[model samples]
Target: MTRTTLALALAAALALAACDRGPANGAPAAAPTAGAPQAQAGQDAAAELDALYAEFWEESLRLNPLSATYIGDSRYNDQLPDTFSAEFRQRQLDFAQRWLERVRGYDVEQLEGQARLSYEIFVSSLEEQIEGERFPGWQQPLNQFYSFPSSFAMLGSGTGAQPFRTVADYDNWLARASNIPTLFDSAMANMREGMANGVVQPRVLVEKTLPQLDGLIKDDPEQTLFWRPIAEMPEDFPEAERDRLTEAYRSLIADTLMPAYRALRRFTAEEYLPAARDSHGLDALPDGEAWYAFNVRRITTTDLTPAQIHDIGLAEVERIHGEMRQVMQEVGFEGDLQAFFEYMTTDPAFTYESEEALLADYRAFEATVDARVGELFSLTPKAAFEIRPVEAFRAQSAAGGSYMRPSEDGSRPGIFYVNTYDLPTRKTWDRDALYLHEAIPGHHFQIALQQELEGIPTFRRFGGQTAYIEGWGLYAESLGRELGVYADPYTYFGRLQAELWRAIRLVVDTGLHSKGWIREQVIQYMKDNSATSDTEAVSETERYMAIPGQALAYKVGELKIKELRARAEAALGEAFDPRAFHAEVLGDGSLPLDVLEAKIDRWIAAQS
Candidate 1:
């Protein structure tokens, strides 16, 4: 996930009515008005809210410089805050509270269309942030999944969101990256505090962090991942500047970056590991029950308790299993579900021979989808994306596939990173669903189109609800047949299996955190229930352990989206347009689930 996604990883989708740019083939959500008084009020309201949102975004960028860099803003590129510090935490809380009050001052009922939607999202997000301050997530910041070291590596390396186009860009990075060691020091201090408070990370996750740090901590700066910019410097640069950049980067990597990595590694292995808890779930810590509950609400953007979500997961899993069995019958597999899973996973034809072949096949799948995607999605993003393997250092702990949204300025294309680590686990059947979820019509479509939306605030464009984002990704996986993939029965099974994995996440995530399930038990449940390989099972289990309530988002979000679509179809009958319904869902950007449902209902009513 992108840094922005992780930062604002809560909420769902919402939009305006189709007649007034709300849904059904209308423009981006904008305030519509009639009469002189109403028009003036609308203008004043829009002006005030727009100004507030812009101010909030600008200050936010200053506070979160990495966010600016990711969105193609370079003004704050040379800064990195010690975000894990209590002082910084206070600043963030104050920021949220202050902004929440400002946005809430508006007469929200008087505001209509996108204006009201923006107000609700801004206020809700801020309120959630403030409410969540009671839980000290900053203290236990180092996880295998979303720690500073991993994100820093991506930014410093030439491949990620940080720009390397100009000589000044290189210099800005040098200045910015110099603060990393200080940040690492702060992280260690926070971890020490967490240790004292009985809030340390699971030892299993900390163990994984060690190898990740080792992969980057090289003796020679030139050998380091951070050295990529210097190595791949553009030939058009003047010799003097190139030489200057090369040495500066070398010094930066060796003196600053590598030492920071080593320090973090040593801290993790020697001091932190011994202090880390053996337990696997968030519920193991102090006030962990409330902490997990807050996460469950925040991640899923719903009041459905952990028990409710767990029951939903069980039902969905059983339903998907039945579907998978039918696919097995279609494929003429005589064995039971487990044996069919084994056949699909271990069959040579279902596995790729090489990383090169895996990437090539994904690229080919993109073309195949593009040819027919128009049939399903008239609402598409202008931004393009590419297929690449995950960086070697992070692939083991990374997801099977993930999408990085394109830059705001369009300098970078969206990236669909397919993990090739443990190549046999990178099943061929999995590619179609994964591609649909992570690339076209999934993240890149929702996120990039969100960024592309006119007349919305920057926060709405960049920040997101996890349920809305990942939910859309999972929902996109179901559109495979419409987009000319999932043709074979086994490939269709891959779609069901993918959905089944998410359903399993709901079970095991709740199981681990709320039900006192062990790490081994979670892994066992995944294997017993799905076609997940040992590698996927382990990594996914740890991911749930790392971020307690996140796994629930995919299933929860997907179910809501599916429900809305079904409602729209039933309401509109022959008049229903899937494309227009889709536009309504995405047109308003990521929203809270209730807001999305309400907005979709309006669109459905408009069509009816």
Candidate 2:
């Protein structure tokens, strides 16, 4: 997912409706009024901004209960309102519009620094949500990559963000789980509408989703993934509560969750699969080109068209391929670019002996990189992080690594899940760059530090821009050399491989949505361009298929950051300080690429 949707969708799914009293660091939450005296204005404005922010956050959670859950709030856990319903969807749109209007009326000039920027970001995001209603995203929600079936399997496995330790927890899920049948029925209806309207997913993607749903359907309640809560009910619960919750959960699983999954599975396999499109491009659907364009703007936060992004991707691919060729020469590989890719993939020396060794290697890189963080960054996060394998149920289709943000209360550490599904694809060469991007100095550092900022309003602290966030992640991959991993030629090749993967994403993501590339064609392009194994290639291709413009973020955002950085270094000549430059880039949290560039220009002018 692009950082916007990653944050916004997660916010939609996970943020809760709790009142924000203030900053978690003990600051009082309130914002100052306008036209106060200059001397006292700063303090008053800070307080006023805090109150406005707290209201915004509370309203946000209420509007998007799923977000509240992910942030660790239990207030709406038992309430699974039909988020896909037209009424609820309109309510969400109205919520965004009202909040945008309310916050805009507040005299932001009274606020200073981070608070002002936070206001802009909040307004921009809400406005973007309102604008995005034109696209029919709800019609095509369940894809192979991240449909509710797979998400629930991960949660019901007793290992995800969903908690099952209390009777309340069990009851919450029971209430939530009971709604699955309705959602499934709605999904089948929506897919029918899509098929009639010619907006169906590619046949290949629909085919892959059937098995995922089938795996979740069970004849017996105890055999179902959803039955885990009943199996592990807390011993301390009152007997009445335990007995009541256990029976309710069992019935919910047997009569509700499983049947819904089975029905959806059968419908996809028997009905939708036959009607699914052979064409891959979103542009082929009704208003598909416009939808793809909207996604591009939402993801990149720029007006650049699909064709523009396509050209940029082509240039980056060529540049990175040249670097890989140099790496081939360094390793004394005898043939062309594809030959070197083969050598890297087949070489036994680059493979991990076991999953334990793989995890150990990543942990070791974390320690090594942590030691050097102070050299580059002036700010750091208080939240801790851990490296874990992607949960097995979804790992087959998961990415190499991804970060889950920390709980608002810090009860849970941020998790960086690395998928080790196919051992050879999980190469030692890939680990260093992956570690930097998903862990230490990449997502965990950027997202967690933003969450920990004290004076910024809660929304700003929590909010993100995809370009800035993913741009930072891609930039983090470049730090492998300074962080000490790229000294080895093979490891350096890994960094290039990672970059190449992203570059290929730029090509294929646009190619699928705009240029009419078929599913196999996209998969073929990925396999030809990088050393990713067949399993990894399939997963990555499906990910791009699932989210139309998301994969564009990594390369698009990275290119903008790198371009700006080069400009800054050249303009400053001998006076440039990487540490200070990084501080400026990160200190304000995430911003649009244009906004980021403008801010950097101001910083450069001030330094000069």
Candidate 3:
């Protein structure tokens, strides 16, 4: 599963600048003598830059309150922005331009080490934020995978990043959620504009969204997920406080939220669905080819075109198939790759009997991983994680497993949400690899550790590059054997199948967006190639359709990471330490692929 957050959709568009001077590891450089004017000047410049970074993070939090809430900042919990509005879009553009000019004023040549690195990254982030404005993503904001409506439900439902413990927390949500009607109005207006300009979502995605909104919209306010907090209200509160808060919540749902939801559902069904395009690819829209090209560059953090990525995917599919054949031979299977895939996918022995059993197996596997995770890497995050089943409302569209990072203050544990929606499709062979990817040593370790990093600017701490983040998760799956899991041939095949799936994403995602492959064609390609179930194929296919160029990040990132590992191993010979290499790769937060490569090269040089 990809990283999902309630933060602004454009949050990833902003670049991540570094904070602490020194290196990516936050290690300080030698201090210069006090009498030296150049040293004093450099220190002064670095100080000024740090101040700018702090100010930027604070301003950004106010602009995107949900971002602050996710990161454990409660300063703006009662605030909500109508991010889909034209005025808000212009404000973001203006903010990016202003920061770009401000950061660029610093003489990057005068900056040293990580200070220089931060300057470059900050500038790139601002430029990307500016460049991305050309695409008009706000025009097509609502999709099955993610949208403000869906995200708001998650926040108000009381089980997500938004806290519901304190009375203030309850009040904060009531205040924040009261803006739903306005947000929905703004979204509909933007989508209507999109409908006029041939920029609407695919019909199938919109169709899927209708059911989701239906599930959340109820006539009785008490029945909705929004009432979860009220139902589970603290007993310690005074009787009058509880009674008042309860009534307020009921009114909030009935008077504010339900009407907004109904209107959104009505607009989506009656008007938008009719105008929704039949075509699946982003390239089908106006200026779509260039838009998709930009998405490819930003999502993968590379200049590789769609064609190149498609070809790379083809080669990877072939390579991983060869490995799967080896697994088949080990198991003494007497069938071709397709038959093996069928056996792996359909055989009842691999299916979980119940959601309870599925979750139990994952919990047990977490312990299994913790037993020997020490051998692979010494560096680890302080934040702990829990394996929970995905919430029912959005499970149909959710991935098999996804990770949510821990809060900044360490109050909340990192969540690895496993989808137990279709219990039959939750295969036994798939669990280990999924756990490895989404929980231990995958997203949980990388993201939570990044959040725990000290001295980095908040942007670097919370900022994401999809290729770096998802790539590391995919790369983590490859370490199953080394981490003491993937013991059986079947489990090992699960690892190969997981990797093969990512490889297939590169092909199918690029195929749909750039190469004119339709939704059915992509789904067929997945079934033809790997051990994926029908539920998974359909869900994943629509996911790519909903969010173009995102699927490419997993394999592209994993390949880059693997390439670097190989390079480090070869250059260092026996002197290489996997733990140290892992540390160097993750010491800093998310980076653009090229920036990551350059940093790794420096590490290799240092080792030599």
Candidate 4:
């Protein structure tokens, strides 16, 4: 799953900035004497850059406080911003530009290794953030899938990032929660600007968003999801404190939250929906083609054009389809490729009888794979994770599975949210590979380990490249056999099926955005190419639309990783070790694809 950020229009994990300086607001200081000798000066320059990173991180958290909550920092628990407001967007732009120039003011000649890596990535990330400003994302902040209404509901649900453990925690949320109405107004104002400027979201997307808002609106506080804290209130508080807090939450929900939800719901359904566009592709808006290209650069961290990525996706789809044919022949399927796809998706024998059974089976995969992790990985996270059903509120549009990072303080474990929305549609053959991708050696391992690395600045720990992050997840699926769970031919086919699905994404995501393929065309392409159900095809297609160019990352990333590994194996045949290669790939956390390739090449040379 892609990491969620409260950066509003900013790419969140993919965007932030850094510079030269000492630490700020309690972070470790890294500074050098101004006139030190050359060797010492370089070391000090690197150290000072680290100091800048720490300070940037501190200031960034304060600016986007909800990010702190998501990353498991509690100090900003009481903060939330109206990110949709014009003022906030301008301030964010200034923040990006200020740091971009600050970072460029430093000398890169005085840095090397990870310190240099941090500097280069930090500057690129901030530049992307500033370049992204030309695209009016704040005007269309609400996607059918990730609208603030639903995400805010999740935060208020007492089970999300907003902590509800202590009375102080509850109070923090209350203070933050009370700001919802103002934020809602700001969002509405932004949408109004979008309508005037012909930059509105598609009508179909807005239609989907309406139901999500409907779920959040309730006249009575007790009937709303906001009452979750009250229902699950901590037991330790004194009677008077409990009574007072309970009434306060009730009033907060009824007075502040419900009205906001109701207003947003009405404004969206009645006012905004009518004004939303009929066109779907970003190419339809003014400067839309360039806007999408900008998003592509920001998302993938690469210069690859739509045509190049489209061709790459096509080649991958064709190659994976040939592999699927082999799986069909091995399984002794009677008919053609489409028939085999139908069989894999439709066969009842490949499904669980109940949700409990499905969840229990996934829980069993942990031990099964853990036994063989030693074969491929020398690095493992100390952070624990558990499997959970996708919450009902967002499961319909959520991915088959997603991983939320663990809390830094060990207060919350990383969560693997498996979507059980339609259990039968979730095939038994699908689970093992999905397990590898989302939980085991996929997101959980990569993300948690990145967070756990020693002496890295907060930006490196938390920032990510989608190509590296999701690419690693897809690459991990290829390790199913190594992890000892795909001995069965059908299960191995599941691994191939997962790979095929990602390969298909490259074709369809580009088709919808750049090639003018309609939603139906994308869905039909998916049905023809992969084992995913119609439900999954439709959901995945819309997901690509919601976040254009994002689907391209998986295949582009996986191909680069696989290519690098092949080069390493060929170059250092006698000395090549899979475990060492993996450790090296994951050693410095998520990186841009080119940077990853260079790092692996360096390791191969060292081995020889």
User: Model 1 over residues 363-477: C-alpha lDDT tens digits?
Assistant: 9888898898878777788887898889999999998988888887888988888999999889989988988898878888898899898888877887788888889989999
Question: In order, what lDDT does every prediction score?
Answer: 0.82, 0.76, 0.85, 0.81
* Lowest lDDT 10-residue stretch of candidate 1: 11-20
| Clashing pairs in model 3, backbone N/Cα/C closer than 3 A | 15-125
By lDDT, rank the candidates, best first. Answer: 3, 1, 4, 2
**After best superposition, candidate 3 residue 54: deviation in angstroms?**
0.5
Candidate 2 regions off by >4 Å? 1-50, 104-112, 230-245, 571-575
Off by over 4 Å in 4: 4-37
lDDT per residue (tens digit) for residues 211-304 in model 4: 7777778878898888998888888878887898899999999888888888888898889999988777888888889988877776677889
Over 275-351, each residue of candidate 3 has an lDDT whose tens digit, in order, gives 99999999999999999999999899999999999999999999999999999999999989999999998899998
Q: Model 3: runs farther than 4 Å from truth?
A: 8-40
Instruction: Point out the worst 10-residue segment of candidate 4 by lDDT.
Output: 6-15
**Model 4 C-alpha lDDT versus the unseen true structure:** 0.81
Model 1 clash tally, residue pairs: 5
- Cα deviation at 45, candidate 3, in Å, is 1.7
Q: Name the top lDDT candidate.
A: 3
TM-score of each prediction: 0.94, 0.90, 0.96, 0.96
Estimate candidate 1's alpha-carbon lDDT, on a 0 to 1 scale: 0.82
Backbone clash count, each prediction separately = 5, 19, 1, 0
Q: Count clashing pairs, candidate 4.
A: 0
